[model samples]
Target: MHSRSLLSPLARAALLLALLLATAPAMAWGRLGHRLVAQLAWDGMTPAARAAALDLLQDEPDPSLAGVANWADELRANDPGLGRRSASWHYVNLAEDGCHYDVARDCPRGNCVVAAIEAQAAILADPARPREDRVKALKFVVHFVGDVHQPLHAGFAHDKGGNTVQVNLDGRGSNLHALWDSGLLEQAGRDEAQWLEHLRGLPLRQGAGLGPSDWAEASCRIVRSPGFYPGRAKIDEEYGLQWSATASRQLRLGGEHLARVLNGALGG
Candidate 1:
């Protein structure tokens, strides 16, 4: 008969190490829900827009495309079922909450991403700047444009925009911020391309009906929704039934608006 004590200490250590290795990628990239936006930026835009997007993306000190790509590749290699959309939730939350200069307080009214976008506009508007520099400026604008659309990126003063609100997602213990970051998007079971296609099909209006301030306000409106966490005690059940759909719709709308603004900004 096999005994529990039959395994050596080295064998146990090896098993533990292997398990950790298996789970590490999920822990890293699974939580980084913003990969979809980056992927879309890289794939969906025009060549000039893509270049501009890359320039804008450089504002984030970490979480670069290469870093996310490596993390994603590792996760996919380990688990073929892991989809790129899995990262959108984390990305939205990170953009909203993590972009803040102060974790203890609300994000500054004009944050880094906002500032970067405005700066890019200035560069793009400059007549004397070279085409190369203008392209670089446009890249930053494209990236930051996507960033601001993430509702969580425009977070609230309280709970660090849901980061401090702990809850369980589908019985998996997580935080409110985390739920918004990846939980709902993962539940959708669709890839980024599919999601983007859906977003593109949404009813979109034209001619400056929305702008940067409007984007910020829209996110804040969602973040401040009265029913956001109805019945605080039953957060998990409530989120499953109500908040998840809200988050999904918000993400879809955000992506659609992001594409619209980029197309307009680039004079497309």
Candidate 2:
């Protein structure tokens, strides 16, 4: 019933292509989301974890948790070679096999986000690592923890983590990936103070009951939910509202999980 029905095959295909994007889903949480997680982690860090982390952060421009929130993405420009080398570490593609994650098949070579979290935690935990190296490791561990909790970051591989699913989120022309990355958070209209308050209000965890694959599976389930697609580009404000809780929950989870990771590795 759409205009595409009247166009030639090539024209229809091209028209559809024009509306899609194939980029890696923008880093989860964009800048704001990551900062929220960092602040939460910092607020709850043990004295030992705080000391070890800040020691590595000696010369950072902004010597606070939120300060380095976007460091991993910034490295894409600040240190292009290393950034390229670690590009795949930000997300793991979950597709074809349904909600279950098969580590060997889905995360071969230890390149996926779950592995990135483990690897960076190791570097942060190892006292012998150079201070600068530990700093970089700390940044990625913080960033990837945020990444794994972004629903689309762990979404279907077929759609490039929903990057290919074109949509309009609350009057903004954007895709599903962009919507989750920050659009919904932005739409919430909360300031950093409010977000931090919300984060603190969430129940503290013992880091039990969930891990990277569980986190990934949780996101995959959200992306594949019947209510999520909403005719793609036709998804509007009401649809976006339905999932605001999900965004909040994921952001809170990111903050909580990151706190545990940092404390476990550096808390001493």
Candidate 3:
């Protein structure tokens, strides 16, 4: 009886995919990338850390440590209330005024990936907090750690972390941010486990005790580095060949550092 056009489930899903491809810029490390990072962290966790994490996840829909890696993102999609409130925690908008990362100017009111990670880490480390609270914090920590490591997530204000900057990948319409999110990784032609194994084989260059803010800045540095942001909007085989290596490195670092942070927080 309504005039509004209702799309079929498949059609609606296609529309959602398109919109998410455009708007899900802050889902740093993409679905596969986040899974890979969490899996590595789970694998590397000490017995005590694993026990602590498992204890908190007793009631989780996906109780396995890595299985709940996308808990925050899934929550964002399904729970509108908490989803809207926590959206900004995914990424910090670094103003284009040079390469400085002043917490006040870059990350105001503690609504950013770096600040969120630090806050959640503190919460998870606090044994006095309720189990539920710590479990939620653990999810955010797992996600935000991956977010800060995505070079485009720590993006400039001008282009909304390259979301506004249009580009092409393998002759398809896309944006700079989305390309790095899943486009680059999808081309790897391997499943998440294969990707994880490949990344684990790489040497991780962990900074000497870097914090969340430092991790964001590291991603920013990579963004500023040469051969990342294509001079032109359209990209092809050459660009992919060059930047896939950097993408791999970023994923590796994300997984490595996530393990370190969780290990430290859980007293591993």
Candidate 4:
């Protein structure tokens, strides 16, 4: 029998909830979006930052930033222990707090993406830390930056970042969270390079003056916008046309933010 079968009913339920929380927000941008973010960050990074990043990642299975861009999401299968510990690092719940991040209320004990990015950036910047540890931190920073830009990732927590909101896409069953994660991008029918080209053409209006918390607040604001949430449950082509641009903008912003973070941490 499975080891979980040995637990009492209450214990089983608690375990299930924990598992759910861990996996729920982790699906921020699908692999394609994540890779695109990594590539964009790479393109924007300074020479010193790129060299440092490559040095830290030298011993990893895939040594490039884009190569490890989705590492955090694959942690459940590749490294279960770290996956459970860092799951909450993917998102913050600020919907109830006026889209503002109050550390004591929304991020108890530094568990959300905003704090996670700050913490990982610190580790990556600390030359005294072990090379292996800093490498992992770099991966987390790349991923969490992308996660924080997903509008629904910082949306109302009652809906668990819209994971609980059911919707239909071309008659297929799906959820709001899933739609933002990859649906809109996939509907564009572009490959990774094509998507990157499309994203690059959009004018980036966000500045480097903002930090992680500010980014989360911006995402939350997007969620609170009128018509941001579809009036109907059907995700038609019109719906995709209206929202995919928003998703693209977020991807562009996420990439720029990551580049700046890495430049600060790794660039001399």
Candidate 5:
């Protein structure tokens, strides 16, 4: 009877292991499983940059608006787990901590993403570091570059920047953050590349220009935009058109900003 009691714990462990293994494949999909945006950036790079970008992407691999739809489709095809988890809340903690700070607290708006990028930069620059660390850092840099482009991720502290504000997404109950993160991408449809191309064609804001600092500042401004809110629900045709346009503009800016940063970092 004592031996039987000891065996029960082992049996439970075996059951737990089996459950984890059964769900592992499903969990290995969507933005959480693979770094979709980082992969896209890596794939789109020149041969010289590709090698370095691969190293950067190893640590972080979340997708951007331009690639989320494609990533989602691939996730649906390859793993059932993608449907269960939402990547929208990955940066929620940053928003909660950084936004609405008086002079006392450090603002996370630009600092959070910057820290991640700097970590990658350090790994890339350090020759003594293990190759694995360099590789992981590069990947993290790639992923964080995309993160800084997300306006809500740069938002104010109050209300957790819309995470607390529940709303109906096309009549399906959801929240503001989810609507911005994946819903907007989903609405853009399956043709992510074409949509991205269209966005790239928009005229740049003259003299607005782009740099890492500029991008960060722009994101902060967007986060503070009056249009960004939780329960102020207005999904009319005009609102849809405006919001889509805004999202497209932001995506283009993000890609362009990422390209510039990579080019400068690689000394190209």
Candidate 6:
């Protein structure tokens, strides 16, 4: 009574595997997303900014914006001391305040992403700072700019930015934060080049002189939107179809914003 029964043994096995994979939860943006953001920023940067960034990265292996885009994320494994110190710099919990970012209330010691972006941009802009320090700042700027754009990174503190909000995505277990971070984007099945091409087709709207706080606020608003957190703990195909566009838009916008930050700090 079933179509699968008509197939050969190997054919049915392949069909079953295909269905499983189609529903399997793939890792989202993660390194790939970061690199996409970095590459997009690099492609959008001014010639002067690119040159300055290159000079700063000359001493490193793989000296490109995309090359070091994930440095901060890997700091825990590569540089544990700095990693521990900067652990909180990647996000801010603002859902408690109606998605409003009050510097004093949200970021007490300049530890959150919004503050981190401002501080790193300042360091990158200062000509007198040690070159080594400035280089690190450059890397941080690239990574944090991308982080601030991720909705959950600017999401609620109650659930640790949705990291604890578990859900069943496709047929596998995942979390809300992970869904935004890389899962939704991964569902598109576009490689970096494909994503770049897709993003390039979208307009890079000019922000009205907005900065990191503004960016974080925007992401917070997305989290606060209706149904951002699914009522049921199950993520269906339609969920990815609906939210993937927002995630891609964020990645593109993150690229544009990172370029602006680098251009101002390094373009001289």
Q: Each model's C-alpha lDDT?
A: 0.47, 0.76, 0.76, 0.82, 0.46, 0.81
For model 6, the superposed segments whose C-alpha errors exceed 4 Å read: 1-28
| Tens digit of per-residue lDDT, candidate 2, span 18-136 | 33232234778888899998888787688999998888887899987789989998878899999998998888877557878888988899988988998999998988998878898
Which number leads on lDDT? 4
**lDDT tens digits, residues 31-70, model 3?**
8888888887787789999998988888887787577778
lDDT of 1 by residue, 43-123 (tens): 444666545445544654453442333333343365556434222322222224433333223224333444555556677
Off by over 4 Å in 4: 1-26
- lDDT ranking, best first: 4, 6, 3, 2, 1, 5
TM-scores of the candidates in the order shown: 0.55, 0.86, 0.87, 0.88, 0.61, 0.88
Predicted candidate 5 versus true structure: per-residue lDDT over 1-268, tens digit per residue:
0011122444433432333223321121124212434433443455655555544444434323233323333433556574233232123233443343222243243334454455556666565788766654454455556666666656655655455565543333445655556444434342445544555466554242544444555666766666666335534223333466666566655555555555545543
TM-score of 1: 0.55
Stretches off by above 4 angstroms in model 2 are: 1-25, 169-172, 205-209
TM-score of 2: 0.86
Name the weakest run of 10 consecutive residues (lDDT summed) in model 3. 1-10
User: Better model by TM-score, 4 or 5?
Assistant: 4
- What is the overall TM-score of model 3 with all chains considered together? 0.87
